[model samples]
Target: MSRRSLLGLGELALLPGGAAAPLNAGPLNGALSDDGDLARIGHRWRALATRPGTAAVRAIAPTATSLWPDLPYPSYTETPARLLAMARTGDPALADPVARGIEHYVRHVYTPGASADGNWWNWRIGIPRRLLEAALLIGPSRADRPLVEAVDHFVHPCHLAAYEGHSTAANRVDLCQVMLLRAVVGADPARAALAASALTPVFPYVSEGDGLYRDGTFIQHSTVPYQGGYGRVLLSGLATLFAVLRGTRWATSDQRVFDLVEKSFAPFMHDGFCMDLVSGRGIGRHPYGDRRRGREVAQAVLLLGESASPAERTRWRGLVRGWGFADLAPEAETVEPAEGHRLMAMSARAVHRRREWVAGLSMASYRIAHYEHGNGENLRGWHTGAGMLYWWARGHREQYSDHFWQSVDPYRLPGTTVSTLRLPDGAGAAWGGECPPARWVGGATDGHFACVGQHLYGLGSTLEAFKSWFFLDDAVLCLGAGIRCADGVPVETIVDNRRTDAALTLGGGWAHLAGHGGYVVDGPLRTLREERGTVRRAYTTLWLDHGTDPDAASYRYLLLPGASPELTRARAADPGWVDVLANTDRGQGVSVASAGLTAVNFWQPGTVGPLTASAPCAVLVRERGDGTATLTVADPRRDLDGLTVTWDRPVAAVVRGHPLLTRARTGRRLTLRWGRLADRGGSSKTVVVRLQSAK
Candidate 1:
């Protein structure tokens, strides 16, 4: 079949079985358009066309004869494919180069034995998809037989089917794309149905294992939470499939896919900044990994927005504007208040956002690794997932940007409790080293308020601590307990490790690190600066020196992001804003009475305020002040089959928006039981129940 004829077979045609019908090329014709994107495509084509082809390949990849050795060689195919797409839009300037580039790619790059087996997957799927896209755009003739045969040889149906039950989300998405594209170009109805059916396992959501968790965490390469790089690739591929299948026989009716774009994915984005936790070490290794100008979220919004409904388009456009893509929609304003908190149960990470500040707390459970090691970066980041918090507020979006790789002490990440034991240069570099299983590794939140805790085990040392953070409206209350290390090294908890040339101020039980924020320590505080080459960073840290006593030590402080010296002192003196309900090795609790909220991390059954639980759990209780109260409960360790809570008030309760089946009132106490924590599944394993005071 000729390329034009293959693409023209857009009308739905039935197969022998009741399989999905094949779609025409109409959706691929005029549906995707972006002027800036087109201009960039044209520029890439012109750059390749002007260069001496052999000389360009040699200069780009002098080490080997294979085209894949050259990083830009893949783009050599992708650029022409995109240009050919532009040619159909009546751009006559790109016609000649698009044709010439294809011939060059087939002759030099696509030759047999030129591709390395190591990247066989990319050559088989990634390269062929682009070539096929270009051939379909430019009408195929009898002369194009070699190109079609080359693509068919590399991306055969059997090879694509082998990856049907792959563990990684990105791999599955890529394989599906190749299958769908090959089915379209080859005019094979059975392959198209196979591709459509294969998507059933991955589409909408994958809550259990290696795909996208319902909590919005995307696990790739099996264990890495890859919401930035690999996750974006999955999202882009899915968006492309959605666009191509729109109004087709294989169209999806699931709204959860759309919900992923809005709810799960969008929360990780702030302005144009993506938290480095999701980006992994790309922020330090890649040239474009600078956190200041992240385009992952923006690109996804643009591509996905193209296929979204009018309402979703407006919402995505607003997001694009907020990401500083103002040229796309000049009138759209940034989303305001950006206020909410989400604890991704699967990854054991919490994201808290206020109007003036945004904080991400990285924690790890036995189910997830404390930190990733491949790529030569973050080799010493053993403590990143052990209660390491990254804070971004006004004027400090790029605080740790650029200098995080080797400039700062990896052990002194802000909001982390670390023993001063120097890591042996490449310690813990191996992939997939999870922390020891411990209770209180997760947190609880009710949208605006959050309480996260961790029973931390220091990497490569005998150090243990209980770290907790209470994310309130204006300030974050940090608490630590059970900090005991027998290594004789001092234990320190970093309040803020920021990159700035600003001077440090110490007075009135408060220490201001820079204009970004300050710390109100409950005890003696220490301030220091470390110099790397010509760069210097100031840190406001608290110290715990335990010689050999196994006695549990504790510390408390308030992190005031975007606060001035005056405000820091005022908050340090004001005890009314925060109240420590319980602080011990067994359990930790806090109540922000002004917010009418009490949060407890119970290592065992304990009491905080008028609420008590019968087992180890994390609970967040909010008195809504309107005869109603909201309670969020979770078993962070994921061990409890069930737990019960008794509140000293007569009330009727509803769990997850449904009235509980078994609830009783005895005297003035209301009792509720949440059962089958493991059966509920997902990382959260938590339930939100609303209680109304009985009349």
Candidate 2:
């Protein structure tokens, strides 16, 4: 069969409007139903339609002066295509101007510089895809030919070949979309096959420098973990292409892509908000990030749901409903359950969720940075990567909504342990690749519980500390040790720092910062206030002020999100809820008996409770009450080839839900060996072993 014969375009051509019919139906079968979405699309259309020169095509194109020359035409091509789609939906006023705009775009707007710079990849893919949809809606005409020919410039073999090894996943997906659209519109199955073939490489393409890691860390620009920024672009492009290719010969059946969506992308969402840790500098760059809205993830879920089978659609619908987006909620009940705690070891990020609260810990390592100091955004985000933690519950989202970028003290971010040295004005504001030079900067999790540790090094200062966070069911236990700095500045560990109008009270070994939950302080506590613009917000900052300590200093604190004053007082009075099993330069460990979980971060080979390991590792154990315990072990340094774990109790072990072969029982002691740790693809060398008490 010829490549062109596979698409069955002849059948599609005879159906009402030929190649242009699908465009007229609106993108993704009229998925833009939200009032905000419709308004934004309408506004874009109105602006383009009312532009002075859009009503008529130019006789002579303007000379190219600037790289992106303004040619008395709409700079963006997608606007006109979308407007034409809108016009077909009973609004004839948009038709003439849109038709004229498309004419102007093909004649003058698609310039040589734009084509050569490859900046037009986004427009080349998006505009033509939408234009084809518009043509389908408006019916075939002379206008359709020009639009199709213009898109050919993007999807031609020579142009499409350049993006084959593009640095970012987003660019690759955009290229695939262009190829797929050209294949569908041109009725060439060869291009459709090429597009389908392009998508397969991206599914398992784990770039050692950038792209999706097995631990769910998405990196873009080679160095930044951008799950919320460029990662969104990649996911949205895939979702749209999947929707367009559904029921077609080019449709994908790759389970890895679907697994990435459900397992990797889904965990980053909490109540429709992508955690800021993976967002890079997006929060400081745009208002959307500040609002904590995970709109891209929501849109992808909804669009994928539209093309999903009955069972998968139910699961996608349930995930969307839990995000708290009222518009995406389905009328029928959805059976998909909410995700639990996760420690993305490759990303060095931890997400802890309870029934009412969701908290995220953003840490920096030799691999990740505190913040990206580029693109004129996030210039002042110095401490965002120093174990910065953000927790959201009822009424807490609005607390720091407007205060993160320009307001609030950068050194006093919640869950950060830092020196009090003020960052020199405009120190790291310039564009440069700045990553923390630290190792052993990751965590371990058994699905429900996690332990994250970082050997943190201060930027532009000689400060170092061993910081750790233990995420339990109801609370996060934060510990800091091995603190030493010759930088003359006082070192302090900040716990629960946030902007709140709620009154603060400090007494009974506990402090309550209203709108930010409560904290059980293991040391001294203080309140700080900063005024920015018209907002005067107070911050209840709990810290152990180690002033010029030449030796190691340490501190401990328990963060209880959504806790009442009485509960906070009672918890502070009882220390048994959290046990600090170890706090030293070599290791940091904690046990939460209430949750029946114990976590230990062995800075080196060490012992904690009933378990001992032979190398720098992280261990999380959940006592499952039914004569079985779930043990999660990880070598965060990524150096150990093998490690042996010994338990003081008689037990039999299973690895990744399967019984292990390398096990032994001796004198009531159980031992297991995990070998070839660094060879498990790109994932964290972590293994989940379910151990049952041996009779």
Tell me the deviation in Å of residue 165 in model 2: 5.4
Q: Write the per-residue lDDT of candidate 2 for residues 328-358, one digit (tens) a residue.
A: 5545364343547777766777777777888
lDDT, each prediction: 0.63, 0.64
lDDT of 1 by residue, 1-695 (tens): 11122122222112222112212221221211222222222222222122111112211222223323434454544544444444343233443444455656666666454664444555666666666555444333331456656766666666545433442467776777767655554555566666666666675566544677777777765556777767777776776565455444565434656677766667777756667777654546643364433465565555565556778867776876775566555666655536788888777778888878888888766666777776466677677776878888887766666555556667777788777788865466454455456656777777778788888887777788888888888888899888888776777777767766577888777877667787878777766665652344443444434445344878888888888888887887887778898878778888787788888888779777677988887888787766566777777777777778776765555444323323434445666677656543324333344455456
What is the number of backbone collisions in each predicted candidate, taken in the order shown? 1, 5
Global lDDT for candidate 1?
Answer: 0.63
Our model 2 lands, by Cα RMSD against the true structure, at 7.6
* Candidate 2's TM-score: 0.81
For candidate 1, the clash count comes to 1
